[model samples]
Target: MVGFLGTYQVSLDEKGRLNVPAKFKGLMDKQYDNPNLVVAVMPDKEGRKDREYLIAFPQEEWLVNEEKLSHLSGLDGDDRNKMREIYAQASECEVKSGKILIAQHQRERAGLKKEVTLVGMSKTFEIWATDRFEI
Candidate 1:
């Protein structure tokens, strides 16, 4: 599969609900029987606050990654820490009426406001505050 491919401008409702782009939604439905997604705060390699964003992975895709993470040796501290951090902020959301409700903590971590943009990135998609999104 080519995976998700496109940039869609959207808005988050006051309650923190985001309307998934129709194309992305369609792809998810066609690719996975379960309409669930795992949303998490994307860590910035540069640790720049301005570059913060949230990433969403289809449930099946996330499960695949989780399976890999599960095999890591528990004796490795770094690996344990990394898994803890990733799982700590990850949220499982169900697509309902073409929308998903982003948790408040995830929204705040990404500095998401009213305007947001959804960028397709292969097996995942990203959510960025419109003002913070730069080509």
Candidate 2:
């Protein structure tokens, strides 16, 4: 499957809208043909300081992940909580006029300021604070 690639530096407007790069946008249009996206905060896995970021997935791709999560045994407390957290933190957004608006809570959770970096990651893309994103 064709996937997103490369890094883009973007600025968040006062209203929290991000103008997605044309290359990535084109890929999304051609590959997914969807204007909807799912965004969620990704906490630092290594417990590193100031390393939190946000991940965006096309609606179709997000649904695939949701399907996988559905197979997990809800009888297990941990599995149930994991599903709850993942579903709770994810937000659906629409790409309008080549821009997507990041929710305020999500932006705060990711520590997003004015300047941000969008990094392509195959099926998904990540948004990181420019200062915290290391090469």
Best candidate per TM-score, number?
1
> Tens-digit lDDT track for model 1 on 1-135?
878898999989989999999889999989887888999887778878778899899998998989998987778998887788789999999899999999999988889999999999999999998998888
lDDT of 1 at 111: 90
Candidate lDDT (C-alpha), each: 0.90, 0.88
Which structure among the candidates has the greatest lDDT? 1
For every model shown, what is its TM-score relative to the native structure? 0.92, 0.92
Question: Which portions of model 1 miss their true places by more than 4 Å?
Answer: none
Candidate 2: 10-residue stretch with minimal lDDT: 41-50
Q: Which stretches of candidate 2 lie over 4 Å from their true place?
A: 47-49
Evaluate residue 125 in candidate 1 and report its C-alpha lDDT on the 0 to 100 scale. Answer: 96
